[model samples]
Target chain A: MRTEAIDPPGISWHRVSPKYVTVRLVQWAIENLITVVVLTLPLVFVLLGWWRWPPLWLAITVPAVTLVLAVWRLLLIPRQVRAIGYAERDDDLLVRGGIFFQRTMTVPYGRMQYVDIGVGPVERGLGLCTLKLHTASPGTNASIPGLPAAEGARLREQLAARGEARLAGL
Target chain B: MTANVPEAGAPSAVPVAPDGEWLRVHPASPFVRGWVALAAIGFFFGRDFFERLLQGRPVFEQDFAGRAPWLVAGGGIVLVVTVLGFILTWYFTKYQISEGYVRVNSGFLFRQQRQARLDRVQAIDIVQPLLARIFGLAELKFEVADAGESAVKLAYLRMDVARQLRATILARAAGMVPDPARPQEAAPEAPEHPVLSVPPSRLIGSLLLSEQSFFVVVGGIASVILSAVTENRGFFFYLIPAVLGLAASYWGSFNKGYNFTAAISPDGIRLRYGLLDTQAQTLPPGRVQALKVAQSPLWRIFGWYRIQVNVAGYGAAGSNGETASRTTLLPVGKLPEVMSMLALVLPDPGTPEPGRIFAAGLSGLDSDGGFVTTPLRARFLAPLGWRRNGFATTDSALLIRSGRWWRELVVVPHQRTQSMALHQGPLARRFRVADLVLHTTAGPVSPRLTQAGLDEARSLFDAQSARARLARKRQISEQWLATVVPAPVVAPVVTPVVVPTQTPLPQQSPQQEGPQRG
Candidate 1:
């Protein structure tokens, strides 16, 4: 991995690094499973005659719709995986992502309350980790997922140290 | 099901091993089986047997062969399920204290683990469910202020353990000597400082006077009558249960209200109460952010007032474990106690005199409570009615206002006040009234002092604004002195150099410094 520190003197804004693709993919998988299950379950029930079996044409139509959706999801996954990024500027850490409705969030390091490094079973299986940043302000928490465990720990330490320094200054 | 454990070389706080005998006394656990058994009997044998008898079906007829096996199978399933539930309930329920936190680990397939820090705990309430009270056991519910969750429950702790734990946590948090270990010689005279208990008469009086209780009783009766008419049931069966429930609830309310006394010690204010499961909460005064005293029109006849405070970590009523009660330090509404409590908890806002002076100047109302302003500006809204209002102040400023419709009372600290603005709407202009908005860095503290007299309002706004600006300027100078001056001799020498920049420094200083350093 290559690390670069860019300080464009005139620009005050922060941007996240583009290497957060793994995080986006992990999140997408969790969210997509629910959608897939909800779409597929009715067809299974109909075929098994659990309640009342649907007409043959209706059964065929539902499966066809689900198949098309699955194909569409497969094609869009890579582009979404590529868009994730995070960056830290002088005053704030920025997290940027989303393909359709782009979102860029800035959290001032001075206001950070704590940092957490977590790994779930799927992420651990994939050799990935997550970093959750919390602040005193409610409803303004950000999580960066899909980094290597060592990298996640290092980033958490650096961010926590920076937060302590800023709080001491105030 | 075991997964890979992380390498144990990391320097982190060691997880304390839990201590004490693994014991539980859940009230519902033992009797819950009995209810299930009764339900099964009712669902199967009783219902089928009664229905068959009513329809004149024989016990050992030709159709009995097919039905008997199905009945036997169903009974076996019910028995197995009940026994399994009882086993799971017994195995999964346990709580223990380890180090400075209480750890509760439970659930069967989906496990839940919770740890609460003793120090962060605000209050602990023990709830005795209707069934639980019969068994002489209670559920200990902990209210932790900064715990990132609502409340945690330890099911079926012996009432003694729950009380001991509450006292232990409170003593440790407040840094007080444990009451249990106090010398025996001092115990006898301790009763001299009598516990302030509300008499039975007073408790009933308070409940009857409460608008909340009145609403409950009226609503309950209305619902019972409507249900009886709609369902076409005999009034006896339906109304009896409703009446009984209400009576029980009313008694519970009275019992909780009976011992409500807020006593102020040097440490904090302690409030103690409860009928089935008693609770005591101690809150330090400094933690309170804002205080409000409110009264409805009905309560105003009896000079009753309800006081509420915004304390950090104190959640709204139902969201936390506290049900049907406000997050109130004082439950009983009284005027004299409210005044004394305010004086004890909050800093002296200097006296009622400042508020009187400010109110008089803004209202143009005489000491006899008569309006001295012209009819166009000052029109009386109410002649006889309950007024919702109060006065507030910081150390350096005061404010007072009273109105039913467009009500406000704002006080901003002199140094903290940022800017003042005069706002005029079309209706206000017709009445020669203007609203003065005072802005503070913290937030806006605006009081529409009087709407009728535009001239007087504007003049007062100007006078207040000037005083605010002067105070702000003095504060800034003092801050500058604190930041800039250090050593005795170095201060005078460096003061002149800093003074130039304090006024306005050109951008050239940065450019000059870059070349000089190189």
Candidate 2:
């Protein structure tokens, strides 16, 4: 028995492609841009004193809050992308992600039921894909995003072969 | 033995369909299915018709005799059409049970064929609805892996034939050779030894003291009091739906747990339960992903406990609101009954002193019996339950206990543990505690040891991964009949190697320097 921490100190982690930062930024903008636009529209009228029906505090606070949340979210994307990493081990795949609420999962090759390689429209335009490993258990959420298509294929093939070799029954 | 049963290696005994040797289901299958729906429809429609007839004025007396023949003819036409529909449906549905697969070809208007590999079967259920039972028939449901739905449902086979067929399938699935020359045995069922039967008294008493009773009783009293005091009738409106919901839940549990009996046969762990519609579920050994023994606060007074399990294909049990009906292993049982059930689930308890660890998991307090408790500082986090919240492990499985009031013990075998995680929130981090969760297939029981010291959580997380890895390699194939399913390549035991380099992260474990290089 050895006393060890969950995040083993020495591991050559494969970081998601740097292009992932742009992908996340675009996704974040798409998600927050709509709310910012809609909420800011009301504030414009309030600032110009065109519509007085909405109370001054309510009109100012709503858009201000949306702007702060959007900017804060935009700022967090790069770090979150940086935090995502997956490592291929001899018998298992280690996936770690999340910035403030960090998590690392160790899924044995034998435990994987299937592997899915998904290329969304945006990721495809960037020549990138996301690889997801599904186990019998739904709780084992292991997905790696922003991989170069070629790298994704290689990982998928390697993972599938290893999974087949170590196939364990449910 | 029934004449319908085929001899081992015989091509077919029952008349084979024109299209190969596929066997047609009993003619009464559609009738049995139709009978239930018809009964429900009749009940509702008859109620309204009878009520209206009783109130209607007497204009029918003079013309009734003249119109009787016309009314009878209309009713006869409808009955003839319905019965013809049922007969046609039954005629079209056919199934072929063979060496490596069970294929079902069914449908009249639009034909559909389905085939599931015998090795992939997760469970076999022999269900006997009240109507079907009257004809001595049962339905065989095949739960296959990958797809959560029952792959093949063969309805209305004679009870004996169904049992014999089930035994054959189990034998075949276990990788037995389909020896054509060997004579087939009459009934292949390995004698089942009954393990536990919940007495009606306990079921009734347990239900009476359940959480629903507590809420209903308190809510009823409060509503009555409020309505009486305020002179308002609005409280009764809320109470109506509450009472109806509570009644439905009670009925569901009662129906499922009635006559509940568990036994171990060669085929699997057999469960016989239900009052009106009896069902016998056969869960093969090692099918269980995880199990939880739970006792609500009210149940604790009577030393009663309930058990629920997670089997791979029973994915919708929780979401469908049939958790109690489908997942319940033991509705209510004493400690001894619980122990026997545990033996069925885990033949190899892995620990020599099983009683000590299990007892600690069930009711032990303060970390006796090799159990590790949440640190004293966790008192601020969970003041009442903190003392009872702890974890213990056997060689094969890990047990986590929590909640002094609503006691629960969750067990997840090492091989079945899909993955694990350690979580530390701002509050838990300040208290130097973290939660460790072992992921398993979807089920009601979630195995989580919460509020453990940070260092302990991390260490357990690492050790758990190693144990799970080894366990996976050693896990036997689905062919339990053939023996252990250990991985083909046996590499010598080595600590899981860390990759040769490290890319620094934002947060590093400052205390992990000693174990880092090793």
Candidate 3:
């Protein structure tokens, strides 16, 4: 609720909407399910005698391993969502994420090429949007996922205007 | 200088290019494209067709003897259609350089018009493909800012005209008068003075000496042996295709860099290279975003270094949308050559004592170079390179020195830095060391100061963040011809035997203030 810009920058980190956890969980489930479906479809066809031989062990192992991985990923969805946090700095935007290999990226306002706000069908249903920020460097893959729609729009506008102003000043 | 720029749409005379005439490419332009198709056809069937005649077999009567006359007519019709297609393509393609924009109109059925604003022109390249080169023709590629996938390309101009057009367009872009003394049909002469050529012997030696070539040769030998052991006579045939493919690529790379020479023109650094197909690329000052001086492990034995750069829109798009060879500053050089190249590419490696820092960057660390090296604990992470993995900063850039056996020096100008990050892996966190990643545009120079003490990394994170911010704020235009006063030349540490590429001597101007001591 507090909108104060903290001193000793990046001290206070803003977390994405809590509902994002559920959104991510669903997305993860869908992705995993797709893998499971792709893996199992061939197995089903093979077992039904509709397809040619694929070695019995491969048919069984591929689906089984993929199902286990899908379940494992589903369990980690919450932690993955929790790891993401961003801070709006005076001259740059900082986004930090990743559970194992933790990464912290600072995208300067002046260097920003463009910013896009996207609301997918599921994200829209959840009143969430992803904020993607781009710079001239193609290496910059900085994006904030699961932001509330209003906050996402406001941030996009602010970043876009700041990007233009900074570019003009340069 | 700014006052002379004609306003958009006003057409108030800038006689840089001939006024308002849509110039068609050389009449032979269509043949260039047609020959490419012909080459493809010949490559697939020429051998078979020849073999039939050589063996005293009927050339065209094997299957079509009953209908030979009709088949011959159909083949002729097909050839005619292909020729017609190429001619139509050439007919539709026309480019006109006006006061404010370079407009290219092409495509026969689906008409397309692409214009690149002269002001927004970043760099111009004159590329000569093998066939085009054989015909003494070149293609002009114009890189415009924010024109994704649609960079205006005008192809198949007479080589002489291509170079002249490049010079004229560059002049207009730099807001300077086009050089009027240029001879109309003058042969392509190497620019006067201070041209650096990568000798063919050294080029071939360097290519063969590469680790990539080692793996390729080793793999080829291994496959050959394996096939021999397997008693498969067909395996030898496999080597034919494999070797042919590898030879083609190797030859392509060689040709791309054959007779490689870098010279200075009024435009900027002009590079001409290629054995079969020659190319001329002009990179004006301030266009290079970042630089990397790398020594492959095998190359280190010979004390050779390769310097590459990231110039937006200039390099060829590599796989994964990355830019490849287009940014090669010096593919292979010794320390002296490397240093000379660094002088041209960065001009100010951000340090007053560029030579000392550059030497330290290429080789191992000196006792008293201003570089901040990794702590003793970092030995576990970079056993051979812990002491050398460090960074130094200058007024306008941060120079990162890394590697031990194969050392690398990455120069990220403060102005060109896109983003900065501090990362720590589990091992790094345990060792109390982190990395400072300074991101520039996708280029060879992804400057990362790995295994720095945590305190140093944090300070770097904060300080570099501030430094990059300030630098971006004061960034100047990429087109520097109008504003550039000849920079004062600094004395080189080791005098290179050959003439160095004439670089725009950008002195420490009053505006680019010293990096504030935090």
Q: Which candidate gets the maximum DockQ versus the true structure?
A: 2
The candidate scoring highest on lDDT is 2
Residues B89-122 of candidate 1 have per-residue lDDT tens digits of: 6456555443345656566555566667654555
Q: Clashing residue pairs, candidate 2? A: B476-B485, B477-B485
Taking the tens digit of each residue's C-alpha lDDT, what string does model 3 give over A51-100?
88787689999999989988887777777777778888888888887665
Q: Candidate 3 chain B, which ten residues in sequence have the lowest lDDT sum? A: B490-499
Model 2, which residues run further than 4 Å from truth? A1-6, A44-53, B1-20, B36-81, B183-187, B233-238, B319-323, B377-379, B484-518
Looking at candidate 1 chain B, the ten consecutive residues that score lowest on lDDT are B183-192
Comparing candidate 1 with candidate 2, which one achieves the higher DockQ?
2
- Per-residue lDDT of model 2, residues B79-137, tens digit only: 67878888777766666655356777677666677877777778788888888988889
Ranking by lDDT: 2, 3, 1
Model 2 lDDT at residue A17: 91
Reference-based lDDT, residue B19, model 3: 35
Computed on alpha carbons, the lDDT of every model, listed in order, comes to: 0.49, 0.77, 0.71
Q: Which stretches of candidate 1 lie over 4 Å from their true place?
A: A1-170, B1-76, B146-149, B175-195, B199-290, B310-314, B318-322, B339-391, B394-518
Q: Pairs clashing in candidate 1?
A: A16-A86, A16-A87, A17-A86, B377-B452
Number of clashing pairs, model 3? Answer: 1
Better of 1 and 3 by lDDT: 3
